[model samples]
Target: MKAKPLRRLFIGFLLMAVVSTLSVATPAHCGKCNIHLLTGSEYFYALRDAIDGAKHSIFLAIYLFKTDNHPTNRATGILNALLKAAKRGVETTVIMERSDDPESFINVENEKTGRRLLRAGARVYWDRPDRKLHIKAVVIDHHLIFLGSHNLTHSAMKYNQEMSLMLNDDRIASEIINKISRFPKTPFKRQP
Candidate 1:
């Protein structure tokens, strides 16, 4: 009788251990989605590839997209990719931060980059001055989402310790896209 009770106790302990291990190993979310944590320059490469591979549509709402279009610029590739995507018939739409002060660094750079994108057939919008749209997000093909701290700037992409998540969840992507679409489109003049 003693042996039987000891065996049961040992099995119970083993079961609890296994359960704990499995729980730790499993993803916290219940959704069947693939999540990749992108850190530092990894985000740039991933985003470049994602943009390059975009087929139907690409929606980008960014806080800062500063670029000089220089050959050696790290962020130039991403800018080129967006322009290329638009040229290739992909519907690319960009919503950038519009500062209250037009001559602000963010405003100037975003306008410059936005003009380039606009000329390439991409629809560009500036957020209202009163409301700041500091979203750093990209949705590709209504299926893939890149959301986090990584901005389309050289420092953030190449140097800053930025972190972002690439989620391959259609439901979440759809929700994000809807939200992005609803962002107030305030018109602003593009500098020549």
Candidate 2:
């Protein structure tokens, strides 16, 4: 009688313990959120390869993009690659920050790049005038997403110490895409 009750109690405790252990052993959400960190020339190459490999779509939001066609300009290279991708029927969109002062050189360069991208068949938009969108990210086919401090600039890729994380998680990618779509668009900020 008492022994039977005690045995039942022990069995229940064992079951609970097993369940707890299993839960603990299981990988937590975001635990396997495959993330890679790249730097220097490797970083640029990784981004280029990712862009070149994109088949469905590419979404890019950056703070700056160079206008001139300098041979050694990193931004120009990335821009040209993106344009090529767009021309190849890959859906591409670029969102840039709105210039605070209308006459700033940085603003001019950004405007020129936006126009060029639009001409290449990529949709372009500017961030809200009140708030600048400083996010640097690239999402390909909603499967791979790269987010970091690397701007579309030569120094960022060649000399600056920048950190970028590439994640292949679909859940995370969808979350980021939703967040990006929620950003407010500014009106007539550029030719695009």
Score each candidate by Cα lDDT.
0.88, 0.82
Per residue, candidate 1 scores C-alpha lDDT tens digits across 1-192 of 899999999999999999999999954552888899999889989999999999999989998998985786767889999999999999998999987887889899899888889899998899987888889999999888999998898889888988999988887888888888887886545843
> What digit string (tens of lDDT, one per residue) describes model 2 on residues 1-192?
799999999999999999999999964456567888878666678888888888989988888776477877877878888999999999998888876677666677789898888889898888876887889988988879888898888888889998998888777778778898889975334542
- For lDDT, the strongest prediction is 1
Q: Give the clashing pairs for model 2.
A: none
Candidate 1 residue-wise lDDT at 28: 58
Show the colliding residue pairs in model 1. Answer: none
Q: Which stretches of candidate 1 lie over 4 Å from their true place?
A: 1-30
Best by TM-score: 1
How large is the C-alpha RMSD of every model relative to the true structure?
Answer: 9.3, 11.3
lDDT of 1 at 133: 88
